[model samples]
Target: MQLRFLLCLCIVGALAQSDYDEDDGAEGKKDPKEIQDPRGHRPVSRGRETYSAGPAAPPPISGGSRYRGRPTAAPVGKLVLEKEEQPDSGGCNHMSEKMGVLCPTGCDLKKTVQKQERNVRPTVDQLKRSVDELTQSTNSVYGYVLDMTTEVAQRQRVSEGNGLLVGQYTDSLETQHAYIKDAVDITFPQNIKILQAVLDKIREKIQRLEKAISAQRAKCQVPCKVSCPIPVVSGKECEEIIRKGGEESQMYLIRPDPLGMPYKVFCDQTSKNGGWVLIQNRMDGSVDFGRRWDDYRRGFGNIAFDVGKGHCQTPGEYWLGNDRTSQLTKMGPSELLVEMEDWSGSKVYAQYEQFTVQGEATNYILAVGRYSGTAGNTFLNGATELFGENRTMTIHNGMMFSTYDRDNDKWIPGDPSKQCSKEDGGGWWYNRCHSCNPNGRYYWGGSYTKYMAKHGTDDGIVWMNWKGSWYSLKSISMKIRPFFKQK
Candidate 1:
């Protein structure tokens, strides 16, 4: 607003300056014979007339007089002689000299000079004042823009903080609501139930409002000029993006859930007939995997660049977040693919025909079936006999995700002292623990040394049946694609 006002003032000033120059040009073309009386008389009329005097004597005037003697034969304006006492001999000697004029009659030169000085001085002064005002307005506008930028930055920071707070609050409510409800019901019965009902209504309203806000944010998040997919109605996943003319394996925006804001995802357009969303990738150790529950829920690392850190030269190390993964997979029939590379450059993969991740209410439970690939089916039945009878319990299928902060693994209820994610230094689905711990620590070499193990566990990225628990893979990626049946 301030910028617009300053621009208007500048335009007005320029127009005023232009108009003043035009007035000066018009003044230069004024008739010499038509002069206004400084003391409020009518303009003198111009006519052809001749003045005859002895020897056509030069008009007596002092200091660069404007008047010139008119020849008897030449035509000139008739000079109006005012009624005034005749001047002394020293003054201009002409019929018009008695009125302080001379020859083909210029105005009293003194009065013309006084009128010009009077008109021009104030105009110049006004222009100077206008220039100063414009400069001041420009300074003010610049200051306002700077302040507005700072305010917007601060608001963005605050908004991010609020998002974090909302995530935490929602997680707590989802995780512990059963316990909270039981406690409240026992304490006050009817009164507490009424209050709880009111709270539920308020929560529902908040959720609706959040969905509305998310929709608005999705619309504005991507620029119109960009080839970003339309939110809510289209481009729900990488497959949808491919169908809509997307040809490259690059970062694309998608909104899997209609009530959620759009987010960036790496689309693998050339992999396995295309239309795969890269969910997790770890080639280098640039990004730490030992994050808390909220971190896993919201994701971390950079998804814009597909290449990871350091020498591996593959997709970057990042987690796509549990919430978005669940939203994506639950949309329809989805397939999961896990790819890994050993130190010797040999690559292996595990593909699941049926795959889905439940929401946070189920602790983001993993569901996979019909596995077929080079890599062993460690997800359901490929744990070594290291645990003897407990080998079956090591399967990661149907296990809830666990993190260092929120332990939802099977070991947490049986033996609280043995937390899979805490001992492994990463978050993942654990059943007694995982057979394939892809989110585990990244080791420098294929084999993890005994000294590198934490709590007597090799937490390195391990697909046990393919490379054993002690061997840390060089690179690993987990991606998913929805199955689109033939029309």
Candidate 2:
């Protein structure tokens, strides 16, 4: 109980001391804005200079003046202090007087705590801004990666479509190839059979032609190309029969070459050493001579009657075709004899030692050389003989044969153009009309002066040198024979 009374008295004394300390703190305090550091410096945040703790205080020593320990480093942030007046001495006078303890000078615990709190608020705000920047950068990277993934997927789909199209084209090509192979298999054998049948027909025709040729060869002991009027005999020409001891003036078969035709001709075996083949003969003009080019080329008249030692005995007229005549004349060195008779029964002849008629290509051009006989070279010099003109083209020699249809003559272009063949009404070698037209129209009386004068044309059998262009001939004959007899 007595100990408890003493503790109560101690509590009352401590309460009385705390009251006195509060009263003393109130008297020393100044305004918050007028606060200063222990070194009599104000805080920088309050429009005052910063308090620089220059050097650290030394440690305490025995029997020394009081010392205060302070760090040299400045505070972290803005400091706030109240203003205060400095003591005249440098000891811890204000701290000693207020706290009733020995204290270090230049130390302010209240200001240090406030500076740390100020530094912490700004550090927290900077940390928050750094976190916001990091979040924005993460969003940008995610968007780029999403765009790349979408593009790669679209390309994969396009590649699949291309692969499908390629597969379809390959299938179509294989189908076409199969169809073509099937068609070839179906038609190849049929084509071969058709070609074989055609070849068989050709072989049969060739065999039949061979048999017919063999029969023809058998009928003619010698070579014979054309059909003969009479029986086939072994004679090549009239001269050949005469050489083989044949002395007849009759229709006989003659073939010039072994491969040539066996045509019939009047063999005059009794005149001028015999063997004269008559090519043309005209007496009463029984056959028409004024025919077209084809008719003259193939010959038109028949002369199968017998001539016993005389020409035009049976009153027949004929012209051996130009092709046959050319063949016969070109067999060897042949000669031509033209016999003409007038109404007064006077006979005149023209003969050429070298005479040849060319083929149809040159319009059967005539070539005559070395004339001799009663007729005055009228065939070679027709212009001089008939019209007294020195026109060389009017001559018959070296002149192409012309017809009513084929005008190959040298006629001046004028009224009644191509008048030589048309005016003469027959085929002959005509230039400005001829001096001698042996193939002219026949007149019964042999004189047509009135008709010629009225018509202004001489279209009669006119041999101008023999009688004149005014009179037609009564009878005429043309024949050919070799210059030398064949043995």
Candidate 3:
């Protein structure tokens, strides 16, 4: 029994030793290197001494031989103690504990972080200052841009205003230029014509003056027994005299007469110190007494009595004879007279005087008379008689004369177609003879006498009336006198 006990004791002791080796390290102490953290910090080391609270109680020995080969477990409390004693053996949960225990590398990290923070502070300040400068510069640029914009707008407005003004001025100038051009176009030619007319008048005067000078020189050099006398009047003087006559007579003295005497001649009796003398009458004694207007205009046929014929009568001249059927005979130049014998054997006559008018010698009758008739018988009896007798005088000289008609108080002229009536008896020729005897013992004569004998008379009167009607003239005595200028 003693030997068996000894073997068992030895086995038990070996088991306990094995268990201690497994539970604790082989040295039964923690290594500082193994306790280092992931942050590279080493744990503070405890002294290399054995750790014991007191003597531990022995574990219960197993009686069976099965326990002989097996190791024993340590106490639970001792395992927990071993875990707590290790340095940095825990995970990230132990980082707080290492905060107070810095390693060499940890100090370098702390210093680097502090240096970077210090550098960042200055950089932040510089960045803030740079930002402020940039903002201010931007504001300034914006203000400058705004000012430029405003100035540009203002300049644009001014330009626009100037453009409008320029446009208006251009339009005004154009209008004025057009007006001036039109005025010049309308007046320029007219002004030229007026100037040319004035120049022509001046040239005519100069020519007249030159001719007068030549005539004066010739008159002084020549020695003749007789010299031509200067003219008593000129064309201008004749016009003056006519104007005076118009003023005195209150009449328009122009040809062809407005009363329809187209055969009238305008005699400028300037050289005879006379005014206008009209020659207008029909001398032809044909049965058809109406004169042609064209023949009268050309002074042809019976209207050709001019100054060259003096007082001689033409082939178809007028005649008043006792039988009233004798051929007409011309009078002598010196004794150019128109005479007729009344039923009482009294001689009635008309005489003329000769004068020069506008370089043409003409004869103008001044008086008509009944030399052996009763006193005042040569004077006109009625307006119609005066008109007829004045017409006879006009035929002798182919001249128109003014005869005062007492009935109408108007001058009568020699126009065959002139309007006449008892109410306004103021024309040489008449279609009706008023206040006279048509079929009395005294004869009534005129252009209508022959027509009256052929185609009977109406109301005891004869006339070459319009529309082929015929009428006879009434008997009335009349006398005529030439019209002279009032000097």
Candidate 4:
């Protein structure tokens, strides 16, 4: 009986102690708003930007602090900006002027996380892009080699078509002239007059087919690239380029045959119905397909090519003609359109035309004369020329800003402005920044590189296999040495 009485008394004492502890603990609980960080600072998010970092000690709330009825969701540091002008002693009495070093640049402290993320994203993406460019080039080699051989063969088969076409036209002209001279053949001038009318009608029809060629040359120019993947507009507004996009557009070389090597080409020419072509050759015994793509915004299609070392050719005239439907896609304030040939001859043929639109007003600004040539002709000495004349303008966009070739084991530079921004640790460079997608695809201006790095490209360039051509965007431009073939 005495043991049971003692146990009941002990239970009553324990209950009293428990109640006392609960009341005291409730009073001591953290305010829940005050937070801590490893840096011994409290940062408050202000809007999307501003942040104030203070020492470990809690900051004092001043009359300057504005409460939005409800407590702010952003960190207290954000509200601290207004305090920036005030001495450090105003916020957390413990902080010293040294802590003021935490002041952020124009960049907001809130951007810290985002900034770090950007840095990592591009490095990884570049690696993958480099690999893809390698694969693309390999495939392009096969296609380019085949194309080179085919061009040579085609030239042989139709070796005299150009001359034949000229002769046919001249013969037709002569036949008409003969009718004019021999009035007895028709017993009157009416026969000659009738033939002349027919000829005029035929000429008109032919002129319509050659409108692209005529319109461009009549202006003392050819189609040119007027724009590239320019910087994004500052705001939601868009803008178009006012001048041509291709500057320093010059010859590059390629080797299409196993035994063939690069040569320097300085002269090439073509006649009406022909189009512009650039034939390039590489110093290294390899072949590159001769397909040129204007920046995506001004989508110019493929044209005749004579891609070999030192290959330089004037635009060519053409005889065959076909109608094609071109497509258009606008980028930003400027409208970007792509006009490609629906049907063309063996040598890839296309033209790049650029025009700007403002309200309802439109102005044609630039055109790129495209053509191709190869060492495929006997008379032209195994060299085929792809020519275009319906364009003339200064077009330059330093694409191919970066390129790396495993075969050459070297990195080349393109244009600095196109590849990167001046802000980041590494300023802009052509080959490294602009040419291909940061992923190593051709410069379609689709994908963008991530955060700017001090030295972004390990290999220092991006190479792309576009269509059947291997194009390189180098980072550190040394010599743009390309060669033509001897086959």
Candidate 5:
């Protein structure tokens, strides 16, 4: 009943404080204790875990312990708080114990204080999420604001122009906003002290809000300085950029010298969902394996690359592999191919795609990748060359035009016997074997052949070879041979 009354008293008193503070608004709020809950029904608990005293620590080895051996003793000490009694100054801390009145900090306190802050605190995971988001937001905000400031600063400082005005009059407002943002949360306290701090900071700026706004308008009106036109990549004006020119999605442009790219990853604020990603020449962060990411491309006739610390600093050079299993189990192993998709000027395009390896015999593969980009003449930058003992046609996309295996130094001719027609039959097999085909000339991966057997080839390359080594180009000039695996 007493606890209930206390809660009522607190509520009523809080309402009273609220009544008079109407004018104060967000900033001018009264201390909580000033308010009273007439009903006295306040939220109260016996205490935290330790407070209720359910399970006590096994009695310490003290004299009180009923041990037959040596005795144990606990040192008794007293803590004294010296008080210089003074008249109560209408403060919340002021309370009369004799009058049965009580006052405690508006803390979310439980009986047992040692129950861990977690009981009344956010979990580590929650804190981490909040921190990550806040950090991202903070970085994002500063990125834009700093960019604006830098642009203005770079414009040859206008002696008697915009620079001088921006550097002076409106600086305080910006500074105040910065101060509010920089203010961090203090130790958890009953009163929302941090919130109050933010409010105070806002006030500092609100006081001069009009002056700052006017100044902002005046300075920004004439514009600051303009920088010289400079090319960012390849020393050319990037005025026109192909969406897929450099790279797209999760890329890093880290080159050598000072540094290839800026950040390790493409943290472009403009790319929220996903965007173009360019791997630069030089980078710092390394990709770890075994204990890190599991690789699904090991074995199954798939060629493996070096496993180590790697980053996509430069586009041309990249090292990606899995340390686990190294290859698949049941089905045959896959063939790994790092194909150079495009090369515009100094920039290169590369994506990880797989190819199916055929028989043990070394057979040269003549394939052309599709490039319908008619923006200009299509030129073959060449292919990623792989050399070893056995040479076989592993990568089997639907055979398109033709490919000349440089390693084999031979031009593979397509079969011209089996009634060659899109309606008749054509796929990875058709592309190379439209007519009476030779054995071992073109071998399809089990997966693709089986798929094609099921899917019809009348429309597109045999359904199985739809996504195979088949590609059409305006023209095919030179042939490049890829890495040849040992039999």
Candidate 6:
């Protein structure tokens, strides 16, 4: 029995040594060359068998230690071995205190996971904010596009309405134009025909009235058988004749220069027979001697001719001499009258009348008749006649006023003591038989007097002399008829 107890004791000792060996091998000091991880842990070497700190391992019950302390739970989803406890190295222990964990390696994992969560939260917030901003921008753009579309639609509707209104107005205008055009086309010709017919009847009535006036004028002319023996007919009888006969009975007879060329006279019965109907009150200051001659010869002043400057001192319808007293005188028993004036302030009046002897009209004679006025010592001293070319004559009582006896160019008074002498008998008026003093000499030589005797008289102007000087007449008046030849 004692021998069996000894063997049993030996077996027990052997088991205790085996346990101590296992513990020492696992939890003993490590080699100096083995570096620790920054997490305060060393990995098991690949050559050694390591125990996994898995969930399958349970904590030891209270007894001689299978583990020195309670086993820490393994980190989730990681395969890790429980590290053996060593003496407190200041580096890993200090790191563990800062990390707030016993195992620095595991503590590092927790801190890394926390840091990732911290980083991810801000990223998530940034992403959320960006999404909101994008949503808001998209909404704004959509609203703008919608507003623009609405406005465009409204404008398009208004444009369509305006187009329709314009088309309606155009159609209305076209209808009105067509109606007016058709009305005008239908009535214009009928109105024209009615106006033409009325005009034709009015013209026929005018022609008949003109014929009746002609017959009355012819009857009135027959009563005035003898020529009117007056320079101008005034009074009630002349008014009655003019009223009864009217303008139709009035006629103008013109005699142009160089007697009986072609008729140079034109008559405008509508406008005072041109110049034939001379009214003293109608005279304006402006005058042309050549035009007056043209009007006297042609009854109109349309013909142009140059009247030399010295022929007229001033332009007027008539030229009255410087002296005031002058009168128209009837030269014979004929319708014609001659203008007589004594420019020496002698008032001499001559009378004349017209008559048909034996029913034959004598050649119109213009002769000196009688002198009445203040007669000076110079008897019939100076006389001048201003008549147009056609009305003037060179022959007076069959004696030429222009001719002079060439033997006596100068005049001498008839009585030496009486402003007259026989030596003054050189002039035509003194040599030719006349009522004046036979011994007195007369002076006459001028454009009208000298040239008319040779050229047969034209441009009626006469300058007569008595004693020895030249002078002008005061006034002249005459009536003339203006006529144009029948075409």
C-alpha lDDT of all candidate models, in order:
0.76, 0.72, 0.34, 0.30, 0.30, 0.34
| Pairs in steric clash, model 1 | 308-316
The Cα error of candidate 1 at residue 417, in Å, is: 2.6
Tell me each candidate's TM-score: 0.50, 0.49, 0.22, 0.14, 0.14, 0.21
lDDT of 2 by residue, 372-457 (tens): 89977877777455344545655788788888778888786444565687888688888776788889888887888755532568
Per-residue lDDT of candidate 6, residues 1-487 (tens digit): 3564575456545554555455447866556545344443332322333355545444323222243444455567867666545645444342243233334354444554465556455655666687789889999999999999999999999999999999999999999889878768876777788889999998998888888888788888876643221112121121222333323223222222234332211121233222222211002213333222112222322211114532111112332210100111121122222323433444332222221111002112223323333222112322233233311222133222211222211123232322111222212222122222211222223112433232222222222422212222343233222222238
The residue-by-residue lDDT of candidate 1 on 396-470, one tens digit each, is 888899998888888847466889998887999988877888889888878977687877797998889898888
Candidate 4 deviates by what RMSD? 47.9
lDDT of 3 by residue, 1-487 (tens): 3564575456545554555455346545555654535433332332232233446533223221222332345445744222223444333322233432232244444554455556455655666687789889999999999999999999999999999999999999999999889879977778989999999999999999999999999998967642222122222222343554422211122322244432212233332233433232222222222223222222332312223433211222211111100000111111112233332344333333322111112111122222233222222233223456543331212222112221111224344333232222222222233232211111234333333432233223222111011222322222111234338
Stretches of model 3 off by over 4 angstroms after superposition: 1-114, 125-129, 201-487
Error of 6 at 266 (Å): 40
lDDT of 3: 0.34
Give the distance in Å from residue 480's predicted Cα in candidate 5 to where it truly belongs.
17
lDDT of 5 by residue, 56-98 (tens): 3442232222334332333355433333244343444423331
Q: Which has the greatest TM-score?
A: 1
Q: In angstroms, what RMSD does candidate 5 have relative to the true structure?
A: 45.0
TM-score of 6: 0.21
Best by lDDT: 1
Worst 10 residues of 5 by lDDT: 472-481
The C-alpha RMSD in Å for every predicted model, in order, reads: 34.2, 27.2, 33.0, 47.9, 45.0, 33.4
Stretches of candidate 4 above 4 Å error? 1-350, 353-487
Off by over 4 Å in 1: 1-234, 306-314, 384-388, 412-416, 484-487
| Runs with alpha carbons beyond 4 Å of true place in candidate 2 | 1-234, 306-315, 383-393, 413-416, 450-455, 485-487
